[model samples]
Target: MKRSAMVLLGLVVVALGLAAKQLPGVDGGPAAPIAGPQVAVGAPNRGSESVGVELGPLVIEGRGTRTTSVVGDGGTVVLAAGYGVRTSGAAPALRLSLERRVGSGKWESTSAPVRQDEHGLHVSTPPWSASGAAPATTIAYRIASASFIDAAGVAPAVRSRSVSVVYENQAAYTGLAAQIYRDAAPYCPTTAVRIADLMGDVAGDYQPGTSLIRIDAVVGTGAMARPEIVRSVALHECSHERQWLNYDGTNEGRKRMLAAAAAQFSSYDPMGVGATGPSGPLKSDIRPIEHAADCGAMALEPRGYLGYGGSCSPTQLEAARRLLTGGRY
Candidate 1:
């Protein structure tokens, strides 16, 4: 079975039509700009670094980096680096060093061994403790690297551009969620749901494997500005998480569900923009999952669920209603 694409539905107003009004930032209003460098809490720092020299035939082709922060379960800050180097013979021994700073404090360093694959060399620092840090603490990081002893003994080194991320404690996220949905305040503490605020183009996504809910920085701030939209998107994504958790009541069932879900959305144009094709019809498989999600969101935020505004056919509507009322997927 094909693996499922990440279950992320970009919050698009055009797709929803009249339901568009229910979401903020879609009404031709000025989008809430991401304040700061616009990096996700644990995504790699952006920009590239060049290795000026070469080790035998090996040359750094490209650099891919990501950093992200995780809240709850003893909070952590992670830094990862991926180096694309071209070499056919013996690969070089790559070493990675990561430095971190919290607030005005001095920098602390950690080093780890690098692992190489067909694509490139990859390495990540151990999860740095974020347990006692203040909410919204800006954590700055620098990943430095050195490669030595290829086919011939030679040392080449490079440094990545500096990157920074803010750590939001669980309490801080709970407070933010509570501000949007009063019910969510207790839900966070009771269920121990982890929320990771991401920056850039991401809206919001939930990873069932990790039980991690990622809320785009833009979406989170927009929700704060328009509290009503929060419940709709939040509950919608949360419902997806529920489907992932249950996923037909067995491991194999969950895998099939993932493959189906991934296959369903892959047919759409990126970001659900425009039409699926020149014919201008949305993919048929998308209706049921989306309808189910919308119904779930509506069940929680009834005032906002407006029946997809004729987007669904009578048959699809009937199925969605059954799922909504009877909890049958």
Candidate 2:
């Protein structure tokens, strides 16, 4: 190899060496991975670690840089840094755990079907995903010792350094959904929502029974690649919610009232002002319930991206405003 290539190789080895130093491996005898789940308080043998683990980002090319990754609500997080086991303790056991907390809320273990405790630690592993998050909540995590470590022998640190990753709901990572829900709150107090595959380009729809707004997961993936789309979806869905509550929100009466709204909004232009192509008739936008929802979204913001390809007329918007503000449907 050329001198330059040799030098680069040397640098890579040195970097790996330095990275390994962060999580020192056990030194006494060869370490063995502890087996089985060690979370139960009364288990005969919990588990132990050798190199244990460390927090760091996971690089797709290789190992993540030697630092905990930038955590989001339900996104990337460091997995095992250096895999190993602890064979030093008489009652050999290691306790690995993941915990989380909200603002000043009690810290609670969130270990689930995933292995809570492990003995072997690898240099790099696929990131563990976090879920069930709300907006602005801090989530803390760590791997630690369940049993006492023998200080006299060479054993891994009793507890892995505690680290944290703050993430948002995977479904609403962009905060647009939450914002939409909050914006629609005054008109309809309970603006509940769900994010699902929802198939193709369909961003969202207001379901009748549950009365919950549904945002499409397929389009909203990857930190909401297109926030505007999600935002528009939310606005449209919220409009439907407002429509439902505009009526007494009783059972069959609500159905009749919503149908009446669709009929009234049917003729209203969905493309608001400055709309050009897709010429002829944006049929879907003019459909009964969808038209009403589109108009409602237009009423929210006529010029804003209300639907797939349309907005409402000024007169339609005004009517929607009055209906949304306080008047009956």
Candidate 3:
């Protein structure tokens, strides 16, 4: 077949596949498609996919709600429910109920008000307040439905799968840290404590011999509130951690790595102070690592604040891109 004809054939196949998926099953009649936002029910955890439940002619879909896990002042858990009727003719009157369970406790139910549309029905419960006492805890939620009643009387009940949420302290920072770690997981894998400690100045330094990142009193508590500062500093320190892991075993190896990085980003002084030439070899050796760390920070978060005027030269930016993409120190 000609190239154009083959391309046309491939398109046709994909179109057919999508059309088939939309069609009703052979055994059952036309399957009702339920659509809505994912429902999550806890702290720090996101909701899962929409669930479709068949209640005779009615097709109801329920989703869990999602919210930030941080409970600084207080937090609320949202439970959302949506549903659709599959059969034609007059739609039946329906109601949804939401229930919650924490730890090994009994289920508590709440009636959620329904809003109807041409497509389906939706309902959301009032925010369920989480106890501020515990630092972290998990909550599970499920959705149940009352029988759809029409002129013909009551129909069958509908039930949805259970979903969970996990609430915790510093949820925002922890979530951000988790994302950064995931992004750099292939190249650098460190503990949550290491990432959390990076927020403070004390645990910022990576010790080569011990393979431990020590907390040194360096960053102020107020700095933790600023995400850009935390991200920039974390990425910068993480780059150093990677370098230490790769080169700290041998002095000669470490020197060679630093020399390579320094050669690439040679425009800046290692001491971070605006100095002309370095007074000694130690300063010369240290400059590359500092430059690399800064470059790593810039590469991770280009728009983030990096202190010291929060600006990187064009050369330094280019070097950062290279280091990040090339997987180098």
Candidate 4:
């Protein structure tokens, strides 16, 4: 079966207009989704007089020069370096540097501040915006440590590092989506979002596969809004994923009943944007499908059974609670 595009009907993002809400940040054009091959570069070399240490999500396996390329022609590398000294758990001092290469020529290095933590070193370099003549060449860099003793059974005391190379590249945007994927994999397997392409109101589609739920970006927004919004939205949509699985992807029957119940909950639009009256268009022109969904959504919020957002007063929560839980306060 062909995959269905996510429905953006009756959405709310800066005034829902078609699938525009699905794509955020960049304009809705013919641009392709960002992803590319990983460039291979030389690793920083190490010597026998070096010590190796292991850190969470970071491994200084052995002293070796590593080369990684940025997405743009002129980018800056924020390299962090640190050392582990045997002084009552007090980590040693550290330093950092920023290097820039404007073209396909030699790298220009500059000093950067290094902050040391119990684990390692960290640095933040200025934005790399000048790469010489070639305005779009990749920025490559490497990190190494000063000559230190190879402590027995002790991790290497090399300069621990983390790099943040900035660029006005599409791949960087994809990296943002990749971050969302990382978060969705473990905690929100039933729901996910790639914000890079989310437009105005058109959110992604929800498909619950045999093992997990997949939400692809038809349109995405840039890395905007706090993660709390993402978490809340994803959690909200995840409830739909469960609903789909439980109802076998069809809520038509339940929607009818919920729609009837929602009338009692509705004094105005569920989104708090309009009014709902017997003589108004809300009763004649509005669709109850979304109201049913909103009913379920509001039911899940904290004290949301009390209904917040629309003209629907907190009193509606009492009715909704009774409908769902036999009037149990």
Candidate 5:
């Protein structure tokens, strides 16, 4: 066949493959495929002849009464997906499938299959629920496979893709924000903490919930470096988070939590320290939290290999020690 004829033949094969089946919910016109947000997605390495697959914007919407008991009150939980597919002329028709609550003791299909169309593939399948099911906490959805014929032979290239369960009347992200607020509220001298990634001559405030944590996004002679380092810093701050959440929700409570944290720093895994705790140089303070937060940081080995300097200030350690030991010393 001539080059032009070969190209045309390839196109014809792909068109036929795409038109082979209509998914249960697809409209069957040119698809307006959804674009996935820029995110760091972790998928297992599955070597296949398949090219990259453009995932659609997946949204989970739900509506139901808020209560300690009872699942959705016939409330609607919709799973919508939109994506596009391109294939080799000789490949088989791409098949799309859905699976829910994966890895659980039992596997089940929550919704029927929908064919991919020119408009790409979309689904707004609502799960059936009675008014008396247990309160809905989460729903997990996945694409079982997108099979196509490739040079390697008949195979389902993409293993699976999933979206975390979304609660009703709430976005998946809003819940996370709310959780940050709730966890840090009491520790927060003010409403919320500020987070930033910038340059400063001096070390910035390292308050638990109040101070914004800085994450270095750039790379150069001077930068915060990688995400792991930033995350380790955040974990240090989260010690403050635990301080607030477990306390009595009062100033005295905050002090108590801090003091208790100081005491337990040695008991629990200190920063920088490995599973056995800090093994390096020690700080001046006898309190453990200081040891863990500062000196422990030096010991605990973070994934990013960002080295720890020292433990927290001795003043706070003494204050906590005074409280824990009832000021006897």
Candidate 6:
């Protein structure tokens, strides 16, 4: 076959949605706290906690949460607190800090942002990710309020309540993941990105209800082992998230989406989903949703390799353009 013909065949291969070969692939607290904000750890990794601080005559109380184990990069820890007068009738100087222990390592200190107000205050810590740090990763957060900081910014600090959670493959990859997610802003800005080893041929996937797009690590020809794998899979999964964003509102729309999603889940095995490579099952099988996702990924940037294929079929591209360019699929 000629080069052009082979290219067409490749698109056909991707239409099967078994597109090309394998792919690639948080903290603490703070102070005399007065009614801190309430933040659950969140679904799929949610945890709950309620802590109280004694301010003498007035009790400073709040609730915080943490997940036991985090799977990927870009996960975050939220710490919040509010300001009030201590027993000494002085304004409490609060500092929120996070202590991170990586793979049975020493606790590293990290400063966190504090949301404050009379009613209540809460703020999320900087995004945390694991890369080389593993085996046993934990983040413990503490809320502390200095007895008082005079003009010199010195005072006796008394730490209050805290919570901790473990993480996997934390750090280094965070910057890369952030770049991928930032580039994906055109497709889905609100969606999250995670980096971890998916433990199979699977390089990437989108999880429902969590608004998370996962890009696997270099596991058995997965995420980072290959060039363009992370970008390809990340954007590809983001496409799925972009598609679902439209369906999240209505019951009928959700049914349409779920039905399509179910087909995607049942059709391809992780070990055998290569559009042009050996994993493709057939040329006739049409994986429209996956193709749409591929097309959607391409819409983000034309340069990166797509997991399904480097390029998309005209039909799939057109469909994706319709959805991403403001039309419903």
- lDDT: which is higher, 1 or 2? 2
Q: Is candidate 1 or candidate 3 better by TM-score?
A: 1
Residue 203 lDDT, candidate 4, scale 0-100 = 39
Cα RMSD (Å) per model?
A: 14.0, 22.0, 23.1, 17.5, 27.9, 13.4
Q: lDDT by residue for model 3 over 1-329, one digit each (tens)?
A: 99988887676444323211211121011112334433222111124322223421221221112221211112232333444443223544456666667777987786555455443334333343333565455666566666654333344677656655554432233454444444444344422213433332232444331222222233223334245545555565556556544553222345566677767655553343322234313434334555566667666676444322223456666666555443453
Off by over 4 Å in 5: 1-57, 61-71, 82-86, 102-106, 130-133, 157-160, 166-329
Could you give candidate 1's per-residue lDDT for residues 94-127 as a string of tens digits? Answer: 5656666768898777555444444333334344
lDDT of 6: 0.46
The alpha-carbon deviation from the true structure for residue 209 of candidate 1, after best TM-score superposition, in angstroms, is: 16
Q: TM-scores across all candidates?
A: 0.43, 0.41, 0.34, 0.30, 0.29, 0.40
Q: Against the correct fold, how does model 5 do in TM-score? A: 0.29
lDDT of each: 0.40, 0.44, 0.43, 0.33, 0.35, 0.46
- lDDT at residue 263 of model 4 (Cα atoms): 60
Summing lDDT over every window of 10 consecutive residues in candidate 1, give the lowest-scoring window: 55-64
Q: Write the per-residue lDDT of candidate 4 for residues 1-329, one digit (tens) a residue.
A: 32332232122333223321333211211112222112121222344322343222211111113223232322233233333333222332323343445446676564655444543444434445432443233444334333333223343433223332324332332443444434333323322233433333433333222112223353234322335333334333443333333332222323434445446533444443222333323454332323332343354443222111233335544443333332211
Ranking by TM-score: 1, 2, 6, 3, 4, 5
Error of 3 at 158 (Å): 71
Off by over 4 Å in 3: 1-186, 190-192, 195-203, 214-221, 246-249, 269-286, 307-311, 324-326
lDDT of 4: 0.33
TM-score top scorer:
1
Better of 3 and 4 by lDDT: 3
User: Looking at candidate 2, what is the lDDT of residue 309?
Assistant: 38
